[model samples]
Target chain A: MKKEWPLWEVFIRSQHGLAHKHVGSLHASDAEMAINHARDVYTRRNEGVSIWVVRSADVVASSPDEKAPLFEPANSKVYRHPTFFPMPEEIKHI
Target chain B: MSNDTVQYLLRLGDNALILSHRLSEWCGKGPALEEDMALANTALDLLGQARLWLSYAGELEDAGRDEDALAYRRNDRQFCNLLLVERPNGSYADTMVRQFFFDAWHHLALQGLCRSADERIAGIAAKAIKEVEYHLRRSSDLVVRLGDGTAQSQKMMQRAVDELWTYTGEMFESDGVDEQAVVAGIGFDPVALREPWLSYVREVLSEATLRIPPADAFMQKGGKQGRHTEALSYLLGEMQYLQRAYPGAQW
Candidate 1:
């Protein structure tokens, strides 16, 4: 009888200071194997320099039911848009 | 280019072409989905490198053959890849061992070719070096993983090492073709790559908890001279079948 390894979620950081974005998942016997598999599966096209693999079971997620009532208030906030700000003539670098 | 120089370049192309076709044999058959993708992706890289090499060889030949013509039209005796690349892919262990050995040599050879006095070979080598580096890394990682993994895996790996050790010798063998290319500044002497290749491979084997094959192991040769085991003919039969049947058919 064949047994399968656990699944892992792969996150890739393309460069420094950037968040590791979720790429996809794969199976491996351990953390090291997971990272190796992730490198081969995700980074083949110059995709990333850094990888983060976490057991899919360890990840926490909000329920899709929380989509509206728990977060809908921000949708009405027009002030969140950067267009409302006028550029100051002296604030060149910003 | 001298005919020997052209022959040297064609050998490099043939190595990639034959190895790519061998790797594609694992399609839909890898132990895991991720591995399937990895092997296929590797095959794709080899095929792309082969196109560049054979196309350049065709230009050097100046005999009106294009990449397709050179790849599809060539018969077995004309091929000059190392015996290691054209050997059959046995088990998964066999495939990985073959891959690791070839990738190690490929990476080292490309590192030298990047500095070739001939800019065109240097350019192609430099471009392909990155892909080869990743290939080496992936195969080395697997070699370590399986070598250090379960007892059954170690046994399989040990067997693979023993089976493929004989084929490793041919990669370092050079002849008049290589001599001409080296003098013409279009190729590197693969013999010089031997020490570094041994060091790197031994280090990987050490970490993998695998034993190196005994030095007295029987070594096979002659692929560089266009002689191969019967396996290459079978491989080329499948690879060249469509091209031979259709001749000029294209979608």
Candidate 2:
């Protein structure tokens, strides 16, 4: 039987002071190989100065079956919205 | 401006150009998608370096030739690249092994050239060394992994090393051009690169669990002086086809 390499999620930080954003995924035999693959796959066009790779299996996600219980009830709470608060002109930056 | 300097630059340029073309052959045929992109990137880097060296060679020759003219117009016999780079890419192991040997020598050569007496040569070397350093790193890392890999990979890598070992000697074969370059302080003696190249290669092969070939083994030569294996002609046939078919054709 043929074995496939593990899938790794790739993240790229385009420049300094910016967060690493998810770019794509690739298959690699190890973490080192994963980083190299990420560089070749996601950052070929001078897209990033830094790269991060994590195993796809390691990422945790909320289940679609639990969507309502996960937080749908919050949709009915209109007060949770911040639209009622007005921003002052003095706080321009915000 | 000297004839010998032009010859020296052509040797450097041809080596990069030929190897870059060989790597480009792997573009859509790499063992993996990531490997394909990496090989293409490496090829592009070498092609860029080839343009720098060839353009300088053309300018020094003052023959009205530019980088494109030199690249597309030259026949195989006019090319002065090492024979190792002209050999066919047999397999993934063969390609990586050839790359590993060449990158090791290339890194050392460029480092010496960075301090060349000629400011232009030094400047080109300074820019090229960064890309070559990364190339050496990637090739060396792959060599280690593949060499120390499963039994099948180990066998294939070892076979590649032995087969390609004979071709490596041409890289350090000093000739009249080399002697003149050394005397003029424009380039270092090719012989001076051998020791450092060997030491680094030895260390890497050791870490990779591969045996080093005999240093004084029967070696091949003549590629530096326009002689090459049959492989180069076929390579040139395809590479120079369009240019030969339609002179001065451009996109």
Candidate 3:
């Protein structure tokens, strides 16, 4: 029987201002190899400057069923948006 | 174009082309999915480098031949790659050890070739060296990890390294064409690459807790002289199948 390596979620930092955005997941034997695999798989075209890899097991994810209760409240809370507070045109670039 | 130049470039192109073809055999057979991607990626890089070198060889020869004609049409005896590149990929451990040796040699060789008095050769070497560097890192890292990781892995790696040691001698072999190419400023001497390659291989093996095979091991030669083992013709049969079956066919 073939034994499988552990899964890692890959995060790639494209440029200075960008965060380490999750690109995809892959299997590797360890953290170091996971990062190496991430570099080869996710950044083959020089698409990233840095990478971060975490074992998929380490992540705590919210359940999909709770999306409406968790996020729908923000959709209706228009007062929370800064644009909802009108300002005079004198404040350009704000 | 001097025939010496054609001969020199054929060695480089054939090494890359044949190794790429070997790695392509691992397409869906890799032990893991990510490893599959890594091997395929390295194969693509070598294939691209092969195209450049073979295409330039065609240009230098000034014959009607092009890259496709040179790569697919040439028979086994006409190929002049280093012997190390053509040995069968025995196992994952053996494959990585083979890659480690070739990667070290290729990386240093390209760094020297980057200074070629010929502009096109230097330019291609400069670009290809980056890919070779990455290949070296990946292979050496695996060599160290697996060599030190477990008893089974270490045993497997040691067996592979010992088996491949004899073939390493051909990488440093030189002849009249090698001398002329270096004198013509279009090629670098492979003998000069030997010490650095040894250092790199030794250091990595040390870190991996593996010992280098004894230097007195019986050495083999002749791949660079258009002489090859029986494995090469079989490789060509698969690689050249399309061009052989469909005359002048294009994808």
Estimate every model's Cα lDDT from 0 to 1.
0.91, 0.93, 0.91
Stretches > 4 Å off in candidate 3: A62-76, A85-94
Q: How many backbone clashes does candidate 2 have?
A: 0
In model 3, residue pairs whose N, Cα or C atoms come closer than 3 Å (at least 3 residues apart or on different chains), thus clashing, are none
Best by DockQ: 3
CA displacement after TM-score superposition, residue B241 of candidate 1 (Å): 0.5
- Which of the numbered candidates is closest to the native, going by highest lDDT? 2
Could you tell me the lDDT of residue B231 within candidate 2? Answer: 98
**Which pairs of residues clash in candidate 2, taking residues 3 or more apart in a chain or in different chains?**
none
Angstrom error of the Cα, residue B173, model 1: value is 1.4
RMSD of each: 3.5, 1.7, 2.6
Q: Could you give candidate 3's per-residue lDDT for residues A1-94 as a string of tens digits?
A: 4478889999999998989999999999899899889987899888998899999999999999999999999998888878777789889887
Tell me the spans in candidate 2 whose CA falls farther than 4 Å from its real position.
Answer: A87-94
Write the residue-wise lDDT of candidate 2 on B73-95 in tens digits: 99888999999999999999999
List-wise, what DockQ does each model earn? 0.62, 0.71, 0.75
